[model samples]
Target chain A: MSEASVMTDELRKQIGVAGEPLVVEMEKGMLRKFVDAIGDPNPLWSDEEHAKKTKYGGITFPPGILAAIMMVGNRPPIEIPLPRGLDGGGEWEFFEPIRPGDTLTIECKIGDLVERQISMGKAIFIYHDTVWKNQKGQVVATSRTYGLKY
Target chain B: MAKQLYYEDVEVGIDIPTLVKHPTTQQLVKWAGASGDYYQIHYDKDFAIATGLDGIIVHGRLKIAFLVQMLTDWIGDEGKVKKLACQHRGMDLPAVDMKCKGKVTNKYVKDGEHCVECEIWTENPEGRKTAPGTATLVLPSRGK
Candidate 1:
């Protein structure tokens, strides 16, 4: 490995280390803003009248709302020596609908690390595994996010 | 939201309705604010160029959100998205047409829930699959 490689002992040590739990309350206004930004006109996400008639009986956010919640919530940050980082996409498994007023506690941990030689030179891929539970302690969703640092 | 898509209606090899998006810098700014990414590479052209990118690029998570919207719209109110996975293979520039498309890959009843699986992706204007992924959805049964 070159001296400039972003994969360091410190980053490797973070693998499998869990971060502090982040609690986020799903707010209707925030959900509206998120859906609006996506340009999604789904009434279930915004129109209270339409949402009240649905099975959820209230505004239930789209699955993508989880991304907003996770992105904005506070979590331990991995210090990569690299100057730039890019999102490598993610995987999500949803077990229940997230409705307005639901309090979700998200727990995250570094799952793994891999070093790859790319056209841009050496890069380190960090995998984070996160679990989302409701106030009732039921796992509403679990996700894995991939981040590339170079 | 044309009609409620029932489990019996979906079949392997069928294509889901496509959603086309024309993402602009304004939309990216809105997304940055709402998503709290605040990454200059997504909105600041000069910063993105300095970082070696062509220019400001679309947020990968925003594209993922588009894919999610397509799935949710197709499934309608009665259906639920169970699992989704995506990989950002290439960067997409602003003001480009990105089409979100999917095709059913599998259908089955597991654990009393009617499930459907699909191969989903966001295709850039060049017809390249920039963000390829898979999704699992639960659709209501017509028999029930």
Candidate 2:
């Protein structure tokens, strides 16, 4: 059997660490549902009149709305089933506003892999990074996700 | 419905508007559909309990959306959120109200962008910070 440390390094080199691309469409219903489900009553995302008056000139996505879109999917790049995924938090950088009907293609890779001994036992902290680009090939946003798996 | 925050007007130590949100299992269900993170830990109470959680917990990303709202609402339409980062330190269960808050930490101008940095977090009903992080923004200057 492989030691935990060795397993961690090997997983980093093999999976999401291998750097792969996943594509997903940014749908309007999904975007609206995300804003509504979060209990956000922002007119900019819902009310057409309010959105039309804003700089976007139409409904726009909230900055963190991508969390719901990026996560939840069984896409490759970071496809390791380590079971317990503890929340390590995430970082987001926005370049352009995501408008309605835009398709986003993501390129993801694993960043840092460190082994830690916690109260629960031994775990590996995985840093996942993904860049989001619009169909026009413009970089729209990027995120670095932090997760812990044991 | 909101005034734009001008770069010259905001000072360090200013507070972003606070947002208090109460999440429910139904909301989590909706989130599950939207995010695709249908991990039972967020919606299945029985499975969560069997796994040792108090109950089905709110998705940490959902809490992040609430915090993002606070920051964006405070800046109004003219400002831009350049970066946001947070780490989930505590679990937040549904049915409890969480407070999303932020305070300015720094202000500066770089590359012609009037930038501001603030510390942001969400506090569970028990008054413990469940998520803590930082955000950077660029607001339009009155003259620029």
Candidate 3:
């Protein structure tokens, strides 16, 4: 959440670093649930003994999970006045596998706005860059998302 | 661990195995909780309808994961998923069959590493693509 004034602050607060990077704990339970939700039946994501034999040394969430790591707490709404929003897609880069028990810092930087008209309506392709770093400060993953603000 | 996929063994235009996903409302709720995307449109039916959307829609990110799984599953143990990107062009509703499909578009030796690029996507039952994307992966060569 941003510590800012209500009105103009909404824009100001979100324009910058987009508030503090959320700290997320990749607990075992959460990873398991996420694995199930994705329908990934791989034992590397659920089986403890199996994961112990692998290079990751334990269960890990698929790299795609990093794209949404900012959801640990209540995320303040984006102030864009566009009525409907859709995901325009993103470039996600994974550096290291996200394992259970790892703590991550998620940083988001907005302001890559390209306003253009689409069939849906007047849409702005809002780009957001987010990086996830582990407690050791190693960058685990990075993502650039184009959110369609319409 | 699955057997490592060798780069030399793969060829361009080869279809990787398909992974079919059934996105349920329960899974969306779990994704919303774990991923921290509490968007009402993803899990709240009434809220989504009020917001001019059809009933609860599946999260785009979830579909992206399905695509990733399609690659990672075929790439196997020694293979590495280097880069991936996707665009959400359509909405995916719950209880529908979403097929994750992909094929190798190119193969090359980059910095002495055998690499393959694949075009991947998830299609709804009507056969319209919901999420289309690309992925680059490095696989071990048979000799190396």
Candidate 4:
């Protein structure tokens, strides 16, 4: 078997087992930072009064902002020992606006391992999926990201 | 309220305003702080080059974020982003210019909700598509 296959098999074994649901509380500051960093000037994401006049009732985090936090949460804790990795790719589907004060519970799963060889070294790619739901049990978003490790 | 771009206002061939971003190492670091993507490829030039890339590359997710923002801002609040998908086509290096632009490609109305479909892409200084994708958004209308 290829080195990537071996690593993937080990990773599959690690699995983190069953994914534990995580509750992410939406905050305006985090949302604003993302908007500013991305250079988005949409008033709906930054303006409350204007947003309230819309169908969404009030201000909401843009879909990309919703995905950004989930990507942030996918990292290894600083204290943990881990190998370096590359970001291979990602995909996301937005089902609803992520409103401030809304707590989102995510259903996460580690996907299959994909292997690719590069001049640098042998790289293993893994896909991860996270589904976000609101306190009302309504599905809000689904985000998938790919990470590469040597 | 600003006037919403209705299905009547958009045509399949019209171009939308383009977005430009000056990606620097610091910006990547800042994005890493917010994104929690500590992958070496984003910040380590030597490591990235080792991976066969000329230099450190921007995160694919970050590019996707910019594309989504471009569309939603154009469609306005009453508009809803229905679907978005992108395929990475090139690499964006730090201290380089990346331009994002889009064009309306399709339009339709379903159950009283008007929708406009757009084609979006990012270009490097060499004028190559870095990332290309499509988005479907629901645009508000006047009435029945």
Q: Which model scores highest in TM-score?
A: 1
**DockQ, candidate no. 2:** 0.76
Docking class of 2: medium
lDDT of 2 at A54: 78
TM-score per model (chain B)? 0.98, 0.96, 0.96, 0.91
Off by over 4 Å in 1: A1-9, A69-73
lDDT of each prediction vs. the true structure? Answer: 0.88, 0.81, 0.79, 0.73
Could you give the interface RMSD of candidate 3 in angstroms? 1.7
Best by lDDT: 1
Model 4 over residues A51-78: C-alpha lDDT tens digits? 8888888988888765564533433321
- Candidate 1 structure quality by residue, lDDT tens digits, B12-120: 9999999999999999999998888788998988999998989999988999999999999999888999999999999999897999999999999999999999999
Instruction: Please give, for residues B24-128, the per-residue lDDT of candidate 2 as tens digits.
Output: 899999887877778899988899999899899999988888888988888887788999999899999898888999999999999999999999999987789
Off by over 4 Å in 4: A1-18, A69-85, A111-125, A144-150, B1-3, B44-53
> TM-score order of candidates, best first?
1, 2, 3, 4
Q: Give a tens-digit lDDT track for model 2, residues A66-126.
A: 6664532333444444667687888999999988798877777776777777677677787
- DockQ for every model, please: 0.74, 0.76, 0.68, 0.49
TM-score of each: 0.94, 0.92, 0.87, 0.80
In angstroms, the error of model 1 at A83 is 2.8
Q: Is candidate 2 or candidate 3 better by DockQ?
A: 2
